[model samples]
Structure formats: structure tokens, C-alpha cells
Target chain A: MNTAMLLLTYAVVLGAVAPAMLQRASWVERAPRLAMAAWRSLTVAVPGAALLAGLTMVVPASPLGAPLARALDACVMMMQDSYATPQRVLIIMVALLLSVAIITRVAYGVGVELGRAWWERRRHMAVLRMVARRDVRLDVLVVHHRAAIAYCLPGRGGSIVLSSSALSALGDRRLAAVLAHERAHLRGRHHLLTATARGLRRAFPLITLFATAEREIDRLAELAADDAAVHASDRLTVADALLTLADDHVLPGPALGTTPHDTGQRVRRLLKRTPPLHPVVTLVIALLAWTAMAAPLVAAAMPAVATIGVDCCPTR
Target chain B: MRGFGELEAAIMDVMWAAEAALPVREVLNRLRPDREPAFTTVQTVMDILYRKGWVDRRLEGRGYRYWATAGRDDYVAGLMSSALKSSPDRAAALARFVERMNPAEVEELRAALEAARTGEPPP
Candidate 1:
């Protein structure tokens, strides 16, 4: 396989091992979103950088490209036979790794700085606005505007500010429904997803799929929040609030419910959802994933895998 | 005051109308003479009111003086306005809230919004 494929495989190996080893039970429940995000990252950002680093190493360490190397070596033989030296491969790999590291560090710093600044600006404005405090202290700050929705901002105290517009827009019944939707985001701590998406993007800038996954998971988070709002109040009121908010033109603030895809798409899903995965199905899926993930390790530990495989395959 | 429950709203209405805090006895005296409540009941209600963060009390000699923590109109206005600001789709949510309200309630919301927009008391 090309270096890119190999590196992507390596990354998948690392990524899979981490969650399987360290993931909590709740995290397993959230796997659909995380899995989609991982797949998206793989497609969008991983391949190109891995290819760059892998090619740099593979091209030089092995004598496989003799024709190409010899031709290039001849041109520089008089002055610098050193041009085709195997050390170039090592240098290239190191340089690629260094470049990736520096770029990631810079991008992460900038993204964090920008997110913090944006949230800080919102905090100042939010304090001046008067709103009723909900009973639970979820590190959420709600400011009422015209939209009947909720959203979370990532970083720092990441408050979910609502609008006076949304409050007065929804009747008390619907308003309670909407507030529950926002509260769900705080409870689930979906801001962590934003951070994950941001980290993946920073690390693997080329992955378009990661962005799609991030956006989709963000939308799904909204669906989950809608379900929460439904639980807190009437399903119809929450559904109506979602519909009304979908028609709203207000731009989302730094926190959660402000995006176009999140509002409309989320409401639609909430209205149509069958119950989420049954506990048994979810457990089985979790077990199956972990088992599939561990199969390679099991095979590696047991040299009898060939015989076992042969017996299982049975000449077919 | 117009749409309030008995003792709690009445106390607030008195506090809002008065320029200064009133003693429990004075507040009790001001109520219609035919409908006198037990002084202790008034006092208890006032205490409950204070606990709801609706009123502030200061001890004076053997008794206490009570005043509203927020004006009746201001508290309702604040509640309404704050609700509007807390969601993502505020304007539409608010518009829907307004649209779904009964005529009288819609009128009040409209008046509130207009007053808020113009920075004036509702006429």
C-alpha cells in the first residue's frame, strides 16, 4: 500500500485503541456521533499528510526506486553524490513531522484564541441582559432573544445564552420546552464534541469528511437536545418550538442553536425519531465493536490463527 | 396587581405604589377594612414573598418594614424580556409567542416590546 494508506491505517489503529481502552460507558452510548466524526476525519484530513510523511520515508529507506534514484544520482554525482543519499529520506520524514507539529500548534493556538475571544465578548453582553435563572446550574447562561432554541459555545464558561426574542416568541409552555432543549446541551456537554472536531481539523487539515461528520454530529446533538426538551415538557410544544425556531432568521450566537442545519434538520429528526437504540442493541453494538477491534491483537498473540482461519474458511 | 394572587400581589402592589417601605401594621391597615387578615398571616405571607426574592425587609424596632425587590411591572417585564433573549431563534420564537397569545396577552406583549424598544413606560 502507498504510504498514505499505511499512515491512515496507523492512525485508525491509534484512534481505535484509545477509545476501546479508555472509553467510559456513557461514551459508548455516544459512539454513533464519534464514529461518524472519526470516519469523516479519516476521509478528509488524514490521507494527504500521512502520504507526505510515508512517501518521504519509503522512497529513501528501501532500494526499491533504483532506476529513479540512479538517474537522479547521475546528474548530481560530480558535485554532490550526497544528493541521493538515504539520509535524505530520514531528513524528509523528520521535516514532514516537524512541519505537521508546528502547523498544528499554530492552528490550535489561533482557534482557541479566537473561540475564547468570541465567548468573552458574548459574556459581557449577556451579563447586562436580565433573564430568569433556571434551577439547575449547568454552567449555562441563557439570554432571551426571539428565537426558540438553544446552543452551546465551546471553551471557558461556554454559556448557552438565549434571546428575549425566543422567550416572548414562545408561549410559556413552548418556552419551557425550548429551555429544556438548551439545558440538554449543557447536561450532555456537547461542547466537548466541538473541541474534538476542532482538534481533528487542526491535526488533519485536509480531511473534508471530518468537517461533514462534525457538522452532522452537531446537528444530531441538537436532536438529542430536542428529545430532552420533549421530556421536560410536552412533545408537541417542543416540536412546535422547534418548528418556529426553524423559521427564525436570527443568526446564532456563540453558543449552540444558532446554526441553520442544526435548527431545521434537528427539528425534523426529533419529530420522526423512533426510540433511540434499545439498551440491548446498543450494548451488543458496543461489544461487537470492541470485539472486532481486538481481533487483530488476539490474532497476533495466538500463532494458531492460521490453522483456525483455515478450518473456518474450509477451502472456500 | 391586576392579574395577581391575593396577598402576595396585594403586598407588591402596595410597595410599588408607596414611595417608601411600610410597616406590616400600616400595610394591614391600608387593606379594605372588611377583609382584614390575621396580622401573623400577613406577616407570614410577607416572609414567603421575601423568600421568593420578591420583597426586601428591614427590621425596625419590634417589627419589620417591607418593600418590593422589584417593581411589579418591572419584574414581569424582566421575565418576559429575559425569556426572549435566551434562545437561538429569538425573534421568530418571540413572534410565534406573540402570535399564539390571546388578544389581550398579545396586546400586553406588544406594549411591552414597544415600551422596551422605545425605552419608555407603557402608556
Candidate 2:
């Protein structure tokens, strides 16, 4: 019971407040890869801790070390003995149902999200093979369109796509930067991260953390990829490539997506090239991320360890 | 790197290039593969395309003639229109890089997108 409360408190505080704090942090703009790691860790850890808390309530945490069958038998006996009253039994049942419900929703949401993406990509790849020709010089799929465009279709046999006009518009340095950006996305497997974010948002639409994580991951991932582009060409050149594409498109429009600011930010971030966090700061951040993931698992296990020690080495 | 996937694409190219439906034998002769693809292989691939609804086929003169279901340009146009839409597309198939500035202009861009997709506005 104490273990359950401890975990629940951690989950509540982390889930309710961390996203707001993270979003406002200026340091993330300087250390985007770290930001991505933080978000991914939060996604796994928060819900996980909640689920474990629920499980701790559903079953009595008796000492574990006997054979599997005997251990489960002891657990079941403890659950029945401790929850003798109707109200307590009902509470335990509710916790079990809630845990199962969360598990089901997450599984279904992720399955549908990932499955839908895979199907759409397969269909797109087939049509792309028919329509776009592989460019010999650049080795990218080229569509003969005037709108300056560049993107990557990521997954199995992933390929970068560039519009013919983008080809004509980007000079050597900018083109190299652009290619590196798209390549970084593919190499880092950003799509899986994105798809999982989308899935979690779908599963938990009302949760501010999941919603914020989805947007933040999408935003920070671009920054992370831009950092990769810095290796191929200077940051200013990458900024130029962004502006060139923005200028090339003649369309005046108002879909002002919730995140066109991300593009604006990307360009600004490149122009000012903030130095990465110091190694010690980065290491400290890494340790914090590890703690967020590991703490719940340890908390959940502590009950079992306590029970085991009491049973095996009785104090005089 | 190109394998059966490239062959499928090559065969589609042949169908798209033709003015009218052509028999499997003609497709085989027209194919410029690194190595010659057998008549049976061409027929099998065209059958696959027909099954996939990428091609329309008719049986005439003891062989089937196949033509593309839609013009190559139309397919590319549809793809461009959807791909150009700003982020978090339902499928999220394309990780696009068109970014930044000028908010009031989006209304015009939407209309331009619709017009370009419908009309044969080749860039």
C-alpha cells in the first residue's frame, strides 16, 4: 500500500507539471537531442509508474523467492486474506480493471496508429515508383513539380524526395545541408518516435503531457535533424536553405498550422547556432532521464524485496 | 540495388509510355532491363499490375493488352498536393521540410494547392 502511494505521487507530479516546465526551458533549444530523450523517457515512465501502482494495489506484495507456482499461490492467498471486507475487495478489483483498461487502450492505439502508417506508406511507395523517376546525379526520387519541396519517405527502403524546382533552387552548400537534414531524420528513425507520440496522444487525448510531448517531439526532432545538417554545411547555409524554400513557394495561405512557428524557430536557431550544453550538464540531464525511467521499476520491486527479507531472515 | 521492385516500376513505365494498350510481348520487347526479362516474366508482372488495379487489361488476339489506369502525371499531382500540406498528415508518410514566415498568405496557398492539383499545373 505504501509502495502504491509512493508511485502514484511520483506519477501525478511528473505527469501534471513536467511538460509545462520542459516547454518553457530555454536550454532545450540548445540541447534538442537531450530534449527528445527526456520526452521519450517521460512517455515510458509516467504511465508505467501509474500502471505499476495499480498492480501493487490489485495484488498483495508478499515476499517472492519460492517456485513460480508456490509464489503465485502465496500471493493469491495474501490478496484474499488482506481484502476481507467488501469495500476493500471492491477497491482492489477497481484497481485491477483500471490497470487492464490502460494496457488495452495503449496497445490498441499504438497498433492502429503504426498499422495505418505502414499501409499508407506502402501504397505511397508503389505510386511513387510509378510517378517519380530516380535522379541519377543526386540519387533521390525527383518529382517534376515547380513548388520548391524536399522531404523524406521513411521506413523500409527509405528515400529522400526532392521537387525538380527545389533541385534548381538550392545551391551546392544548401543542397548538401538539406540532404543531410533529411538523412538525419531517416538515420535516427524519427518516424517511429513520431508515430508512437501520435499513438500515445490518440490513447490519452485529454492528458496535457502526452499532447505536449507529441508537439514537442515533432518540434525538437527537426532541431535534432538540423544539428546533423551542421556537420555537412555551416549553420548559416542551412538557414539560407530554409529561407530559399520559403521564398520559392508563391502560394499565399492561412492554414497557419499550430506549428509553423517551429519552422520559424528552426531558421532562427540555425542563424544563432547556440552552443551545445557542457558535457557535465549533459551527463547530469542523462542521469535524470535514467532516474525517471528507473525509479518506478525500483519502487515497484522494493515491496517484493522487503517481503522476501522478512520471510527468509526473521529478526530475533 | 534495383531488383524486382525496379522491374515492376519499369513495366509500369512501358504501359504509361504507350499511346494505347499493348500486348505482353510488345512490353517485353520494349523493356530495357539490364538483362532480358522473359515473355512469361512480363506477362506475370503485367498480371500483377492488373491485379493491383494499376493497369486495365483486355484479352484480344490470343494475348492481353495493358494500359495504365491513370496518367503518370495525375498520380504525381495527387501526391504533391497531399505532401505539401503542413505537418501531422493523418498517415504522416512524408517528413517535409517546407517551413517558416508570412501567416496571412496561407489562404492563397490552399487555393493554389487545390487549383494545381485539379488543373495540369506543371511546375
Candidate 3:
């Protein structure tokens, strides 16, 4: 019965509650970094909850309300029972399979994504080394292309790439702003975060929580990078640079360029200048995020403890 | 070190400028007529260049004759495009800049750029 309840909790969280909560959580845009943390925690928590639900059944029900050692003995006895009903054994097998499947899927997805990113970065580095001219003053690579595009390839030896057209198009101030924006992406390692989110989404495409988290995290990464860019260059300059490069499509790969999905919205955000979230509010949100992560573990553990207590000491 | 290392670039430059495909011996001869690199060294660098898809080689008599697959400008342009194409999944990568914006937004951007240029406050 407790196992059923735990499974139900996992289903409700992954299916209904998470999608609804994330949809309504519009304020996430105000504090993207915190929101990203919360979303990532929620993504991890769903699978964690499922694993916990499966583990609960492995622990045998204790009817005597006994001590920990006695309850553990009862669990072992239940496991060793040759006469154990086929139905119960089947349930245990299914639970074990489900937990293992979820874990394997997530791990495989992350590994594939990391490997692909690594490979793409290597190829891009080689290509950049061969073609791009280093501009020491701007600390960027200038590619002699007619199209106006600017982006940064992320990694240790990664570089900011700007097309010759982009250099000619933007004024000095806007150019600086664009440089700052690309620098922010590199400094923050936004590509890795986006790639991780992509991996999780690939692992659990059917789960609304992972899908929504992936999209939100991608958007918020851009917003957070914009915030960082604003520090070095004024709002208008950054906005102008965004507009100038607005038509340029980054070469499809691991490059994290300044071309956000919603340029108008980002531009408006820059104009309004929403202040950063207060430290206390950020702290509270962080605490809530941690609590959410811990909830599934506590939920899964409580039933096992209760079962142990019931078997160890019936009278109490 | 645009794409190729110094030695690789020298090889590529020689091949690109050559009127016809050059064997390793001829490439080495043209690269440095005075000191002259070893035949094997030129062969190795040319092989690396071939593997990297910068040049194509054909069997000419006993040895391989190599030629630049693309002009230097075209190669540089291709590199620029490839750098942009770094995303693992092209379909799901971030939206292109102009595709996301409408005509009205384009006008707004123009206004913003104009305002920035004139030092006028955004209206």
C-alpha cells in the first residue's frame, strides 16, 4: 500500500504538478539563475522519486512494530521465503526494472550528449585554428565572411568569432556590447547547461517536467547572459547589437551565439532594466529548491522506517 | 594558425598556388629550394592535410599528387560556416535571429540603433 502511494506521488509530480507549477511560475524570468536551479532540481527529483518508490517495496512490511535489527531480519526472511507469492515477487521485479531503466536512460542520455559536445568542440577548434584571424585588441577571431554573425565556441581553448560583415556593420560601442555578451556566455559556460538540459529532455521526452525545464533553462541562460553583458556595456548598445545580428543564423552546432529566440523581448527587458532579485528572496528560493530535492528521499524513507517500527515493537 | 599549422599552411599555400597537382618531392622542392625538407616530412604533412579534407590527392605514376580541394578564401568561409554549425542537433538548436523577429520588431530595432547613434533617449 505504501509502495502504491509512493508510485502515485512520483506520477503526480512528474505528470501533473510539475507542468502546472512551471507554467504558472512566470517570475522565473526575473531570477533566471535561481529558476534554472529550481527547474534542474525538479528534473532530478522526479526520477529520484521513482527510484525511491521502487526501493520501498524491497523493504518488507513489519507487523510486529519491532526494533531496527529485528525489522531488518524480517525483511531478510521475506526475501528468502521460497513460499513467497509469485505476485509479490513479480511486483519486486517490476519495481527493480523500472528503477534500473530510469537510471540507465538518464545516464546514457547525459553520456551521449557530453560525447557529442566534446566531439563538436574539437572539430570547431580545429576549423577555427585553420581559418580565423586573431584580433589581439578585441581578443576575438575575425572570420572574413560577408554575413553578419557573432558567436562564441565554448571550451578551454574556445574563441569568440565575428564575421567581417559584423565588424563593418556595428559601431564601436555596439561592437563592445556584442563582445561582452559573447564573453558572458563563455564565462558562464551556458552551452554546457543547455546541453545538460537537452540530455535530460532526450532521456524523458514524454515527461512534461523535463521538457518544460529544458525550454525554460535555455531561455533563462540567454537572459542571464544578457544580465552579464549589461555590466560592461549600456542597455541600448547591447540591444542595438542584438538587432544588428538579429538576422544571422549561427552555424548549427555547439556554438552559443548572442542570437536569442526572442530578440524583442530581450530588448524590452534591457530597456526596462529589471533589478536583480533581493538576496533574501534568492536565499529563500534556494532553500525551497533544496527542500524540493530532499522531499522524495524523505517520503521514500518514512514508509520503510514505519514498517520497521511496526515489526519491531507491536505494542508501541 | 588559422586552421592549419605553420607547416601545414606552407604545404597548402604551395599546393593552392600550383598549376597542377604536385608530388611530395616537387612540393618539397618548391617549399624550400635552399634547405629543402625531407620527402617523408612533406608527405606526412600532405597526408594530414588530406585527412583534414583540405586537399585531395590522386595517384600520379608511383607517388601521390596532391591539389587544394578549395581556394583559400572558400576554405576560410567554409570554416566560418562550420564554426556556426557547431550544434549537435541542428533542428532543436537556438532559433535564428531574424526568424524570431517580426517586421514591427525590425522597425523598432532600427529606431533603437538610430537612437543609440544620435545619443537621443529611446522613445
Candidate 4:
């Protein structure tokens, strides 16, 4: 009964409460890095808690509260009985199979995405090698396109590509800001975060949590990159470069660049300084995030704790 | 130093520079005057290029002659355009480089570019 209740709580929190709570948590925007960690924890904790809850139900109930040895015997007997009954055996088999399927599916999704990204990056590199000229001064690949485009294809030998239109589009200062933005993406390795989020969302599109997490992570990566860019260049320059590139179409595949959706919001954030999050608030939130992750397992283990207590203590 | 990628690029360069279609042996001989690659290697590369729509081939005698269908500049532009098209999420991809702007903002950018070009103060 305790196991069942725990399972119910886990399901409710994972499927409904967590997603809704996160959606309403406006403060997440202020502390994106911490919020991202919390979201990641929830992603793992949901499945982990569900699995533990299922395992707890499999263990037989001890009414007399036997000691360690007797309890072991009861557990062994219950395990045998669980397989002896066709219905219980089928449930266990289905649960085990489902877990395996979910794990394999996510693994396959991640593998495919990474492989595709690598392949595309290789092809882009090959093409860039042929046509793009080395700009020794700027240390970026200069392509001859009239449309303004600036992006970086990330890898060991990745190059930052800029179209001729981009050179003429912005002044020297604004150009520096754009370069700083692209460098920030490469330095931060934001592509990996976006790719992982994409893989998770693709693997589990039905899960509202994965979808929400992917969107938030995508936005946060841009914000983080913008923050990095702002460090090197002034806010006005970055904001101007952003507006200049806003209308230009982006070259696709695995390349990360300065332009992102929500330019208006980013520009506004850059112009208006936001107060730093309080350290106590950040610490409290971090603790709550971890606690939320651990609570399910703790709930599932309560009966076992009681069993251990009864075994260790003797009542008059 | 001369991998399949380099070989493909070499082949494209020869075809793009040539006035007319070149045969397989001719393409190989033009690649490296010092030490030429095997005929089959060049043939295979050309076939791969043809399949990829980078080059067009026509039956002439025992083997086909290949030529670049697009100019080098057009080919590079196509590559750039295709890269943008290849993004799984167009919005996310563009967001990496720039943010989405409304018509008013785009107009502002156009005006700014014009001002920079004509020596007028930016609006």
C-alpha cells in the first residue's frame, strides 16, 4: 500500500505537477543555469522514482515484521510466488521490458543525433575548405555571399564562417560584437546542450517535461551565449548586431551562431540590467531541486526502513 | 594528403576551370602533374560527384565525360543556402546567429544600412 501511494505520488509529480510548476516558475528566467540543473534532475528522477516504486511493490509485505534472516526467507519466498502466479509474472515481465525499451530508445535517439551532427559537420567543413578564404586578420572564413551570415561549425577543426554581406552590414565595433557572440557559443560548447536536449525531446516527445526542458535549454543557451558576448563587447553593439542579423536567414545543420529567436527579448535584457539573484534564494532553490529528486526514492524505501527497525528492535 | 575529399575537390576544380567536358583520364592527369592517381580512383570520384549532382556526365566513347553544371560561385552559394535549409529547426538555427525581427525592425536595419552607405546619419 505504501509502495502504491509512492508510485502515485511519483506519477503525479512527474507527469503533471512538475511540468506545471516549472511552467509557472517565472523566476527560472533569472537563474537559468540553476533552473536547468533542476530540470535535468527532474528528468532523471521521474523515471528513477517510478522504477523504484515498481520494485518496492514487488517485495512482499511482512506483517509479523520478521528479523533479518526470516525477512530474507520471506523475500525469497515472495520472489518465487511472484513468478509462480501468471498475472504477477506477466506484470513484472512487462514492467522490466518497458524499462529496457525506454532506455534503449533514448540511447538510440542520442546516438543517431550525434552521428548525424558529426556527419553534417564534416560535410560543411569539406565545403567550407573549398570556397571560404582565410581572413588572417579576423581569423574567420570569409565566404562571398551578399547576404549577411555569421556562424560557427563546431568541432576540433571547426571554423567561424562570415559572409561578405556581414562585413558591410555592421561597423567595425558591431562586427567585433558579432564575432564575440559566435566565439562565446564555441567556447561554451552550447551545441552539446542543445543537441542533448533535442535528442531527449525526440526520444520522448510524449513527455511534456522533455519538450519543456528542450525549449528552456535552447533559450538559456542563447541567453548564456549573449551574456558571454556582452562581456567582451558593449550591450548596445551586441544588441545592434543582433538586430542586423535578425532578417538574414541562417545556414542550418550543426552550426551555432550569434542569431537566435527572441532577439527582442534578448536585446531588452541586454539594455536593462537585471539584479543578480540573491545567493540565499539560489541556495534554497538548489536544495529544493535536489530534495525533490531524492524524495521519491526515500518514500519508496520507507517500508524497508520499517522492516530494518523491527528487526533491530524488540518490544516488551 | 590527397584523400577522397581532396580528390573530389580537385575533380570539381578541374571541371569548373575547363571550358568543356573532360574525360576520366584527362581529369586524373590534370589533378597532379607530379604523380597522378589511378584512373579508377578518379572515375569513382567523378561517379560520386555525378551522383551528388555536383557534376553532369555524358556518354562519349567507352566512358562518360564530366563537367560542372554550376559555376564555382553559384555552387558555393548553393552550399550556403542548403546549409541553412538543412537545419532541423529553422527558428532555433537562426536564433543561434540572430534574433527574429518584426517588419518595423527590419525596416530600421535597411535604413541603417542605407545610412551607412550614403554617409547619412542612422535613423
Candidate number achieving the greatest TM-score relative to the actual structure: 2
Give each model a TM-score: 0.44, 0.89, 0.80, 0.73
Candidate 2 chain A weakest lDDT stretch, 10 residues = A62-71
Candidate ordering by TM-score (highest first): 2, 3, 4, 1
Q: Residue A151 CA error for candidate 4 (Å)?
A: 2.5
> If you superpose only chain B onto the true chain B, what TM-score does each candidate give?
0.62, 0.73, 0.59, 0.63
RMSD of each: 16.2, 6.8, 5.2, 6.5
What is the number of backbone collisions in each predicted candidate, taken in the order shown? 55, 9, 29, 12
Candidate 4's residue-wise lDDT over A180-284, tens digit each? Answer: 878877877766666666777788788888788777777776676776677777655677788777666443333333333356667666655566579999999
DockQ of 2: 0.25
Angstrom error of the Cα, residue A215, model 1: value is: 1.6
Isolated chain A: TM-score per model?
0.54, 0.93, 0.83, 0.78
**Which portions of model 3 show Cα errors greater than 4 Å?**
A1-4, A7-11, A59-75, A78-83, A247-261, A303-316, B1-6, B17-19, B23-40, B58-64, B73-88, B91-104, B112-123
Q: Estimate, for each residue in A1-316, the C-alpha lDDT of model 2 and write its tens digit.
A: 8988898899989998888988898889999999999999998888888888888887656223233224555545655576898988887898788789789878987787788777877777778877788987876899888778888889998799998889889988889989999999999999899889888888888888998998899888889998998878777667667767766445556535457666666776665538889999999988998899999989888777765556334465
DockQ of the candidate models in sequence:
0.03, 0.25, 0.24, 0.20
Task: Kindly list the per-residue Cα lDDT of model 2 for residues B43-98, writing each as its tens digit.
Answer: 78788888988899888988787899998888888887777776565325668775
Question: Considering every candidate listed, which one attains the maximal DockQ?
Answer: 2
- Please provide, for model 3 over B35-113, each residue's C-alpha lDDT reduced to its tens digit, 9 standing for 90 to 100: 4667787788899999989889999789999998888788777665554452435313322222234446667767766
TM-score of 4: 0.73
